[model samples]
Target: ARRHALRDGVAIVPAAMPSQANVVSLRMPLALYGIAGIDEIHDSVIEAQAISKGDGIKGRAHHVVDSQGASRIGRYGWKADIATLKDMVANAFANELGIT
Candidate 1:
């Protein structure tokens, strides 16, 4: 993919999710990482803020629900309450490659 992007004269930037290991390194409790199901999405939003707070990352971290006011979290891939920018990029890739 890098080669194809280079050959096509396109700029490529890969966004990375903060790994479980990294999240753990922030010194949050184990239970924090265990929150995963859709019901825990709101909890994850709070967790993000707490983790970022622990890590001293500035700015707020909160879930932005869609027009329907639903917090989806990990439902469609990626973390947070809704489809992230990375989700959109990956969906575009899937569409282009007809992956599903």
Candidate 2:
């Protein structure tokens, strides 16, 4: 994933990139476990509008093209690889907590 992001001119920063620092600071193992499915990309335009300003999650939505460049492809999975963390969490809660 890092290699592809580099090849396509995606600036691969450490997981500590400013917008992402807080999430990493959390000490919860449960939160860390699903991170890979959360903070994977950034979309400046849409990000500006999201409730979290697009900075709270850990993985990127798979089908949504990265805003940095055009030659790359998203490589994650869940909900056709485009599922949001909220969706993943909701599904997990339904199965695990029977919230529904």
Candidate 3:
């Protein structure tokens, strides 16, 4: 029901439970859009925010944070939680699904 990084980290085979597939399965594609691939996630969030600032939506302007506590426009996740792909990936592995 979960995915683990293989020794090579090249291909994503599968998990014990395909139905309960790991968060990676759900996250990888989405994360790709967030990290490696494009700025679609950020663009969409920006465009939507520009059109309508939703205090209602689960994610709004989730600015990024640094060690100094400084932050910038968050371009990832529902709440725009993190600012960078590295952080996003880390967060994903840590707490995205709440399974761990």
Candidate 4:
């Protein structure tokens, strides 16, 4: 079951240097922040807006819940799915390293 789960969890995404790499690695560390800090950063980021007739693109902060059940802005992952640095680290350990 664990092996199957790991196999399914692996994702293959396109890269700029296709010949050099196959999978994107979690090489960088996410900055740690308190609940208030996360909220502050989230508020500072530009809110998501609808595309206008001539608008190009707009990005919005993804909202997520922390391990403690508090709401927070997702600051990790490509889709902003992970809520906090601690969560991200734990996820990496469990999924990538099978440490859990």
Candidate 5:
């Protein structure tokens, strides 16, 4: 595949089947790792502001920011960093293949 890709400029490789749950972006400081189902997508939004406060081994069941930056709800991808689906696709493409 490598040789073919190098010579032919492209090669198709099958990917492993995916599971229902997948990783998406989180707003950072309170990262949401994996989402199981579409139904559970907005479940975090309502509580995106609550967290465990105080010092030492601090962990938030969820996270919140003081003045705000990104919002609690994101649709396109995890952390909802990219503003559009197109941006997400481009970023994923670049990161995966190291080709921007």
Candidate 6:
């Protein structure tokens, strides 16, 4: 019963047996933390507005409130809905472990 296998230096694991329960098909990758701070992301948003491209797509900053009720620019989630790493971890605790 080989549940896990490794090939080409990559870990090949078994799929979720619960049928679509832990499967992510269209998930977008987020940048690693410590690479840029919240202030840097916000600054990028500001700099993006100064671009003078040919009617290019404009980027919008998504703001979310953290657990401490502090407003912050979202850096996680599909639409940047999650604000901080702490908030994302808390959400995982509630959704995955059923802990509020």
Best candidate (score: lDDT): 6
Q: Model 1, residue 87: displacement in angstroms?
A: 12
TM-scores for all candidates: the values are 0.24, 0.27, 0.38, 0.47, 0.26, 0.48
List residue ranges in candidate 6 displaced over 4 A: 1-55
Where model 4 places Cα greater than 4 Å from the true spot, the runs are: 1-55
User: Which structure is stronger by lDDT: 3 or 4?
Assistant: 4
> Compared with the true structure, what per-residue lDDT tens digits does model 1 show for residues 1-100?
3356466877767778767535323434224233334443454665565554565575434455543455533334334434444454456468644676
Off by over 4 Å in 5: 1-74
Assess candidate 3 and give its lDDT: 0.58
Worst 10-residue lDDT window, candidate 3: 25-34
Mind giving the per-residue lDDT tens digits that candidate 2 earns over 1-100? 3356466877846654586455534343255465764445554433444335456754432344333334333333443433345545565568656898
What is the overall TM-score of model 3 with all chains considered together?
A: 0.38
How does candidate 4 score on lDDT? 0.67
Residue 90 in candidate 4 has what lDDT? 88
lDDT of 3 by residue, 7-77 (tens): 75768556566676554454345426325543435455564656544565544455567334765666667
Candidate 5 weakest ten by summed lDDT: 59-68
Q: What C-alpha RMSD separates each model from the true structure?
A: 14.8, 18.5, 14.0, 12.8, 14.5, 11.1
Q: Could you tell me how far off, in angstroms, the CA of residue 86 lies in candidate 5 after the best superposition?
A: 0.8
- On the 0 to 100 scale, the lDDT of residue 59 in model 3 is 40
lDDT of 4 by residue, 1-100 (tens): 4344556887657556767667666666544545435434543442434223366765666778888998776876689888876787788899877998
Which segments of model 2 are wrong by more than 4 Å? 1-29, 32-82
lDDT of 1: 0.48
Candidate 5 Cα deviation (angstroms), residue 87: 0.3
The Cα local distance difference test for each model comes to 0.48, 0.47, 0.58, 0.67, 0.46, 0.68
TM-score of 6: 0.48
